[model samples]
Target: MIELTDNAATELKSIIDKEEKKDHALRIFVAGMGCSGIQYGLALDDDVKEEDVTVESKDIKIVMDSDIVGGLTEAKIDFIDTPQGKGFVIDNPKAASECGSGCQGCQ
Candidate 1:
């Protein structure tokens, strides 16, 4: 239920391969209360509870817990390394206003 870019998948795989302990999947979801309104979060988790929905993106498995603040379907996750630093950039179409990078959900 999600689309992941090549760069994003690669970046995510590298991270998972590093931190994952028991074949855990990378969990990505959006939560309220950010500088704009929503912010993206990423974490390496090993527990996939019953309510979690798992989606395959290339070689990476992303677990989505519907009970979370919201869903991340049809979202592209990218890891960009700038001269300053690096972070996960999310492009979400569900957002309402322009928050980052001239997109609806850029934060």
Candidate 2:
């Protein structure tokens, strides 16, 4: 199952509160075609499809499509703050694959 770091949860909660989507769930899914395979996507949605797998962390409901669940089994969502700015990142071990450019992987 996917997991969210404390900072990630707090940041997401703040966003939801600001956007007034308290009634909605955070939808995380695979989108686009990454060099390795797939990329991640996040959105605020109220509908839970029949093929979705939902997990609750830090009082936040996170939903993901069954098809993409396996690839995110051990993923961790984290929020990072630097002098430049702050943002969310996913530390997904499953996503650590060779980019086909002779490089080890994108870390």
Q: What are the TM-scores, per candidate, against the unseen true structure?
A: 0.75, 0.85
lDDT tens readout by residue for model 2, 1-107: 88889999999999999999998898997777666777898888999999899999888999988998888889898999999998888888888576756545554
Clash totals in order = 0, 0
Q: For model 1, what is the error of residue 32's alpha carbon versus the real structure, in angstroms, after optimal superposition?
A: 3.6
Superposed on all Cα atoms, the candidates' RMSDs to the truth, in angstroms, are 5.1, 3.1
> Relative to the true structure, how large is the alpha-carbon lDDT of every model?
0.71, 0.86
Q: Give the Å error, residue 96, model 2.
A: 3.3
lDDT of 1 by residue, 4-93 (tens): 788888887787767755487878755555535567688778888888888887878888777652545557777789999887787877
Specify the highest-lDDT model's number.
Answer: 2
Give lDDT for model 1. 0.71
Worst 10 residues of 2 by lDDT: 98-107
